[model samples]
Structures are given as structure tokens and as C-alpha cells.
Target: MPVLAQDAPIRVGGTLPLTGPLAGVGAIHKLAAEVFVERVNARGGILGRKLEYVLLDDQSQPANARTLYERLVTADNVDLLMGPYGTSSIIAAMGVAQRYNKLLVQSSLGDPSLAPYDMQFPALPIGAEPQITDTEVLLDAYAGMATPPKTIAFVTSKFPSALTIAKGGQEVAAARGLETVLSLEYEFGTKDLGAIANRIKAADPDILWSGAVGMEAVQLLDAMARIEYKPKRHFYLFPAPGPTAAHPHAEGLTTLTWFEEHEPFLANAGAADFVAAYNERAKAVGFPYPHAEYQAAAEYAAWQILAAAAEGAGKLDDAAMAEWLRANTVQTALGPRTFEGKFNAGKASTKLKQVQNKQWVTVWPADLRPSGSQFVAP
Candidate 1:
């Protein structure tokens, strides 16, 4: 712990997808970060110094995120760095962090295998092998049902992380003795899913794993409804939580989640307060689905990890902070996280959440679910 000559506000810089396709979910991260920073400052800040976050709009562009990170490090000279949302933007930010040897704590990075930087830590808890681990977790939940899916279909976007996870899932499904009825890959930004929806309807597998992001899942479901076809079971990779829950076709829709607005998750220290604060802030901004979920939990956890590392090391040194995180577990809003595994990832704490009764709730892993909440097989 080195003493500073003078007390100054610690500036942390990062980018968010403020205006683009991913803007809907991106807004949740921004609001969560804002609430975390405000609470940190209210509690005498990190290391007894005020914390200032310099967030820039990446406009959902990976190229812009790369450039903005370079500016944050070189020109702006921010004391520390936070990672941007999404896999592509996070990868771009990781490149800049590696170049400058800055410690980056990110939340929504989809693929951990692509991250080779030792200074970067993830708060998502998808584990080192998310492609394998996440897939297994999802399948494990499905297998516990009274009627497990025997055949599966995969409709994935060409996006890097989603594609990687979907491919891994296909392999896992094969090993688990499930038949693959249909496997299709589409362009990332394809708007009209009528053709794809018709193809899926024809195949009609027992379960459909949609490697979709943002509103893609909703659009696909809408297309399916037009043809009066629906799968027995469906899961989304990273759909917009609010819109998906509100959708008329979203009942029994399952997705990956680390936290939800429920008993066990809210029981974690500071979780309830954070959720309440985030809800108030979100409502003030006229944001829909103001409840804190996995995305918001992950973002707040990133701040928790960074702050814990800084306080644990008693300094703002990037190397020290990284080492602290690597050595110990930080209890985040989601749960405890450690950066000790492959690619500096924590344990795979990914849980399966489903849209039941027009709300997202943890329905799998029986113990985590609220009383009377069980998997609703369609």
C-alpha cells in the first residue's frame, strides 16, 4: 500500500452501447453501474477517495469501443478501466487493456476463451469454458424434468460468442444422447425470420435452443406465431429480458441467468439495497423492466470486484489489483466470485431462468427457486 501525495478522485473509464441494436440491455448495465458508483461514493468512496466513472457511448460498435478505450488510456489517462458490454466490444476493450497493462473488470463478455489477457477479470461467472459449462448447466436442468427433450434444434446467430456456445452445445447434446433435428446458422442482423421460422416449424424438434441476442428471439417467436407453430420448449442465449418477459409468446421461455429478483439472490449482502436503488434509478429514467436481473447483477459485480481488489491491495496499482482478485473471492451482488480458473474466470455459477407467468424467475436447480416455483414444461 503506497500513500499518495494528494487525494484525488479515482477515474474509471469504459464504454456502453448507448445507441444501437444492443442499446436496450446496455441501458441496464449503465443504470446498475451508476447506482453502484453512487452507493460507493456515499460510503466514503473506494480507498477513502471519491470515485469518478467516465463512460463513453460506443454506439454498439466494436470498432468504436476499441478506439474509445485507446483514448481512455492514452489521452484521458483514466486511473483504471471498466469493460464495455457485449463480447465484441469487450474483446476490443480487452485489447486496449492488454496493450496498456490495465486491469479490466467486465460483466457481459460472452466468450471467455477468446480472452487471453491476465489482467482482465470477468464478473459474469460463466466459468472458463462457458461454451461447455453453460451448455451442460442448461442441459442438466432440462434432464431433471419428468419429460426431458429427446430431440433438439439450434438456430444461432453468426455472432462470435453465441456461435461458439451453440456449437459447443451441439457437441454436448450429441454426447448426452439427444438427436439433433435441425442445426441452422443465420446472419447476426437478419430482421425477417419468416424463412427461418418456417424451416424450424417443418423440423419441429422437442426443444429449440436459439443462440439469439437482443430482440432476435422475440422476432423469431413472432415469425413462428405467424405460421401457428411453436416448439415444445425454447431457450434464448441473451435476449432482452424486459421485452422477452412482456412478449405474448414468452411463456415457458428459458434463458441463462446468474441472479434474479428473488429470495435467495436478494439475501446476499448488499443485493437488496442495490436492487432497490437500481429500481428507483431505472424508474426515474422511464426505463421498462426496472427490476434487477442477471445483466444488472453482473455489471454491479464488476464494480464490486474492482473496488474489493483496490481496497484489498490498499492501492490503485493495476498489477496489485489483478493479483488481489486472482488470489481471493469477492462477494458480488450475484454471489462469490474468484479469478483463479482458466482465462482468469470464476466458477460457472450460471443458472437457468425461465419466463413463467410473465416474469423471469429461477426455476431450475430446485433449491434456488422460490417456493412454489418449479420448471413449467410446455
Candidate 2:
């Protein structure tokens, strides 16, 4: 049996959307997190101090994030703060971290604007640089199509993250000499995609781009199929339909996402083990894991840094641990990363993913592509 540390406990607090519209993704995060904490505790804790994590469900609400953060920092008096599952929640909790001077180790917040937080470091191996670079790469690749996709459309929900993605797409489209025939933003929980579908058809865009959540995306894709409106290509943003949901509507679709399993890692590292563990853990929860490599990679990397910091401090002092983390260089599935320090401190890598025969396949960055683009029959 493992002995418990009696000196002092290192308490880490986190917020996740365990129950909400985005629960599918949130659930995956929770499972991975649970295992991470369990594994750390099993190893006799960190630095002779037990690592305790207090996880709360933010219900995917930005407002709830604010309340939960205050409760954790003020009432619970956690040693440190960790970033949340979604961008909004993390953004909401960030102010509290700043005010409290707690270090925020990031996991899923990808918005480049959030990079400015000096005390915060994303667990994600990549950042906004990829989103911007990849969007341009995607547009350029589309332009090279035998029959250039002259007209493009971009759609997203009112969420700030989705809006940021859509905005990036618009910029890329403009640079590539592609006309954005349609750009629309809808409020959350919108039940109607009929009008949106009609507009896309009217514009006759060769490519259709969307930054929608999983459920909303399912509805929109179904509507497109119902109308039998198949553009030359379809590009989707993060957390969109995966193979299971995407295949039916996205049979001939081309989308960009944050993860590509087949991509050749510059350093093989522990990717195989990570994927296997992640898949097994995900299967236990009855849902195939979310495909974003960044999420899992970040989670793994965050824990690595935390362990390093804990060992360096040899105790659980918040200020001491935070300082240790900033000074340590951590290994990630992507590669070795050193904290360049945050000032919108952006540094990262990205690979493109496309749907091929109802399967998500890596297709860009040359060296990492599985086979190549599977241009659908238009």
C-alpha cells in the first residue's frame, strides 16, 4: 500500500463542463484528467506531498466558470489553478488566476489572444500559430484544386472561439483570391439551419466552411444533405463531426481540425503509448475519444510539468511551485518545449486533416500526410 504524505497537500483546482451540450468533449477531458490525477497519486504523490485535485463542473457556462473559480481560490484555497476544457470557461477563470497570482497550466484553451497571460502556459503542444498557418495552407490547397473553388462560405455560432476560427478562414479566403460568398453568425442553441442552408446554396460557393459545435454541426450537415446541396468541398473547424457523424453528411467533405493521428511526429516519443492509453480510457467511458491531439498532448504535458515543478519545490508552496514550472523545460508528445514566456507568446505546429472514404486522414505538412487528398467526386 502507498503511504500518504502528512506534511502538506498540493491541491490543484480545475473546472470542466461535465454536464452540458458540450459534455461529449467535456466527458473525455474528465476521464483523461481522472486518470492523470490517479496516476500521480499512485506514484506516492509528488515531492513527498500528495497531489490533490478538486474538479468542478462548470456546465459549459462562462458565467458558472466565474463563480466556480472564486469558490476554488477563495473558499477552498487551492495551491494552483488549471485552465478549463473550453475557451470561454478558461477565459472567465483567467482573471481570477491573475488576481490571485496562481499559475494556470493550460489544457484546451487554443485562442491565440489568451497566450498573453504570463503565468499561464498551454498544455496544448500547439497554439494560435497553427490555426492561422493551417487556415492559409488549407485555402491555398483548395485553390490548387483542378477546378478552383471560386466561391467560399464561412459560418459559425456566436461563441468567441468559433468566431475567431471563422474570422481566420475569411482572412485566408481573401488572401487566396477566393470570394467569401456567405458569412453568418447564429446565437447558441439555434434550432434552425434552413435559412443558413438556403443562403449557401444561393451563393453557389464551391466550398462551404463552418465553425460549429458537434450537435449544431450534425443538424446543419443533415439539412445540407436534405437539400442535396453538395459543394465542391466543405471545411469545418474544431470539434466538428468526427468519422462516425461526419461520414454520412461529409462523405465528400474536406475539413480542417486540430488533430491528425497518422501525422509523422518529428520525434516518435511516447505517442503510441499515449494514444493507446487514451483510447482505452475513452472506450471505458463508451465514447471514442475526441480526435484533437492537442487536448491529450496538452493534458500529458501539463502533468509532466506539474510533476517537475513539484519535485523542484520539494514542497507544495503555491508561489514556489509556480516559479518552478516557469523555469522547467517539459517534454511533450510533439517535442521538447521550453517556456519562451508568455506575451501572447506564440509558438507551435499544425497538421491538416481531411475526410477520406468516411475516415479522418492526415493530409498535410508533406512528411506527415497519410496518403494525400482524396478529392471527392463533385
Candidate 3:
């Protein structure tokens, strides 16, 4: 029997929500991957083999994700897997990848529970310490204030992302001797934030924390405007301020960010160039890309993984590639990364940012601050 040729240019497949409730967030990351593949192919492909990305729309459905991933691995014979953008979708895909012993590179999924899994690859750099614990940092800052915000509100939707952030935030508040005057959970995509906004205004929280989506972020801002109630401060996650067109309301709102906009790591080198290119592309498309720093950081890291594994394996096959990726240290724009098992145990997550002027200015968590937080209520 003739030996099957190795090093074949094969397919890499996974799930992505190109449309649905979380469509905006999903589309941004999907577009980023598309752009990354385009750049890779333009540069003569990886290891002299043209890379083909096989994307399927999970449509924000977990069941759909399982179905698509099964197709990728069983039917289409994908060389490897890149996980989906959300927590639920990634978890579903991870199950399949492990079952098939296929390598799965994941971006945008931060379940923390998924960290224990073996088949998963942390496509983005891991934090030195858990970045999710940063809510305490903010709470501590409040406690030390001459006068702490007498009333604090914690609001989030029932989505997994919101729940995770709220869980961490609540823990911080509890540890810091701060009281959560109101902790409420709304259904995802609830447009009528008026009641919620009114309740919050009546309570008069010193700090208004929003653990919701970009649309909800906009809804909160709109409702606040209508009710003429603005908290002295607002903290947010997920619906990052200033990064989207909805940024009008998010202006000056503070929240945690996955990337630092002007960090030396991101300010100079190939990663910086990538960010500039993404910005240019966003402008050309008439819809500026959301999460430029985060998306750029992820794509740059993915390319690093691909390059390191390709160089190490000296050929392309899912098993060989997975082995190389697990064992090798990939030099990324962030820095040198060595994945400890399936997770990158070496990297640290950066702190949060506040939207000032018209840009995301890094603040909090001490290490990656570009400038002192200048978040004053407008």
C-alpha cells in the first residue's frame, strides 16, 4: 500500500455565531479570524501549506455547536479545531474535541471551570493572576475613599458571561465589607431597562455596576438619560465602553478589559502593526471593530501558536500539531508563552479600563495601566 502523503494543506474547523442575539460580539471575533487567515495566506501560508478555515454558525446555540463540531471532525476531516467565542459554545465544542483527540484552539471563552480540561487550548494568553478577581480591587478603592458610595448596585443578565462576572464581583463586595444595595438579574436581551434604571435611581447607588451586553449597556445609558438619573460612577464588563458605536452612553464608564490599548507589548512590534491594520480595516468597513486590543491580542497569539507548532512538527497533522503546541513555547507579541498542559499557565490577565475622551484608557490592576484612571461623571 502506498503511504498517504503527510503535510497536506487541510482544513481547520469550528463553530462561530455569525448571527443571533450575541451576533455583534460573535461577528467581531469571526471577522478577526477571517482577517488573520487572510493575512496568513497572503504571507505564503503556514509551513508552505495554504490554510483553509472551516467556519460554521452555531447561532448562539449549544446544540448547534455540538452538531457543527461533529461535522468538522467526522465528516469534513478538519486537521484541527478552533473553539467558539462564547462560554457555552466553547464548552460544547471542547467535549467533542476531547472525544476525538483533536486539538482545539479557543478564543473568547472564559468559563474558568474549563481550565481543568485537557483537550482545550488557551488561544489567548492566561493572566498571571485571575483577572476576574479584580472586582475586589475596585471595591477596595471604594472602601478607602473619604466617603464610600453609601449604596452600590449590581445588575447583570442571566447569561453565563454575566453570571460569571457577577459571581466574581459579588465575592469582591462581600470580602471588602461593602454592601450590595440591589443585586438583580434580568433576562438576556431585555430591552425595557426603564424599570431597572428607575429602581436603581431610586436606590441612588454610589457605584452602578453593569454586567451586561453592549446592547444592555446602551439601554442602561438610555434609561438613565430618560430618568435623569446618573450614578456617581459606573463599572461594566462584557459590554465594553467606547469600543462600539453604542459607546455614546458608555463614554467615561469604567470596566475590566482583556487587553491594554497602548502597552509596550502591544504598542510596538508585530502586534502593534496588527492593531493598526485592524483599525484601518474597521474604518474602511464603516463599522469600527469592537475590542481591537483584545481581538488583536488573540489573533496574534493564535498565529504564534500556529507558527511554533508548525516549526516544531515540521509537518501538518492534527496529532503532531497538538503535541508540538502542548510542548513548545510560542513567542507572541505579549511575550514568550509556554502552555502548561492545555492552559497557558504562564501569562497574566491585564486590568480594566475606563473610556475617556473617545478611547479606552487602561486603568486598575496596577501592572498594565497606561495612565491614572480619570473617570469622572459627565
Q: Give the number of the best model, judged by lDDT.
A: 1
Clashing residue pairs in candidate 3 are 126-347, 127-347, 127-348, 127-349, 128-348
Per-residue lDDT for 261-321 in model 1, tens only? 8989998758999999988888889876778999998899999999999999999999999
- The full ranking of all candidates by lDDT, starting with the best, is 1, 3, 2
lDDT of 2 by residue, 55-113 (tens): 89998898999899999999998877777877788888888888887777767665757
Give the lDDT of residue 110 in candidate 2: 54
Superpose all Cα atoms of candidate 3 onto the true structure and report the RMSD in Å to 1 decimal.
3.5
Model 2 lDDT at residue 29 = 68
- Per-model C-alpha lDDT, please? 0.90, 0.67, 0.68
**lDDT tens string, model 3, 1-378?**
663444466467877777776666666666667677777778877767667888899987888999999999899988767787777788888888888877677766554555556645666554423435557656644554567765578888876756777877777776666678888889877888999998888877778888777557777788888987777888866663334434555565776655654775574335676666666676676554344666556655665576567668886666787777677777665566667632554455545567666677765655566655543443
Give candidate 2's error at residue 165 in angstroms: 3.1
Q: Least lDDT summed over 10 consecutive residues: which range in candidate 2?
A: 238-247
Model 2 residue 59 CA deviation in Å: 0.8
Best by TM-score: 1
> How many times do residue backbones clash in model 3?
5
